[model samples]
Target: MAGVGSEKVFENDKVIVWNFVLEPGEETPVHTHEHSYMWYAIEGAPLHIYDKDGADLGIFEVPTGAVYSLKCQDGYLEVLSEIGKGARVPATHKARNDGDRPYREVLVEYKDAMPAGGSV
Candidate 1:
């Protein structure tokens, strides 16, 4: 997805912080993040789409006020090492808030990697 009202500001390391508001049924494509990112659900349950090897796997519904951390590790196993990796890390996720209100949250801290880049 192209940059709309998006903002890409970096904190430190190779991490790029992405902050924006996605409209209903509107979202950013599956682009890989440079570093893993921590995502928090603020307003609604955002529908997150995951893809691997150019295939859409499934949709993950993240409710409001939910907090998650990611560290772009290799293969599927690395994705499970949340505690082992310790604290915040790079990760990819698609969130959708289905409630009547909009979804919002502050990704406490996580590595930023390139999101797949585009909707399914």
Candidate 2:
């Protein structure tokens, strides 16, 4: 288990920036997103996701230059399911690079935006 990203590149009172890179066939350790965050993809690839118990979730396509913002909230999965538009990044899960090319993204987590008790 680790933090939200592969490496913590920068951090201050307001936010934490992370560099997330996954080579082909590489998988990240189980991690949790407890704060509101956003990510900008540097490279596009298919990412396979699994729950903490190793249950398959699905393969998600990361579009090049795509950016996503997520809020930390209780019952986020339910909320996202109702919305039915954005990809749902689980509160606790692991991700594997399923494509031949590497998957890269820069993630910015808002420390101040962390929900009380880190629900997400």
**lDDT per residue as tens, model 1, 1-120:** 123225654457644455656666565554444434555556545454544333444445566665555545552213322332333222343333334555555542344443453101
TM-score of 1: 0.55
Against the true structure, whose TM-score is highest? 2
Candidate 2 lDDT, 1-120, residue by residue in tens: 145577888999888899988999999888777777767889978889899899999987778887766766672432222122456656888889999998999987877754453323
TM-score of each: 0.55, 0.80
Off by over 4 Å in 2: 1-4, 75-84, 114-120
Error of 1 at 75 (Å): 6.0
> How high is the lDDT of residue 87 in model 2?
60
Off by over 4 Å in 1: 1-5, 14-16, 50-54, 75-101, 108-120
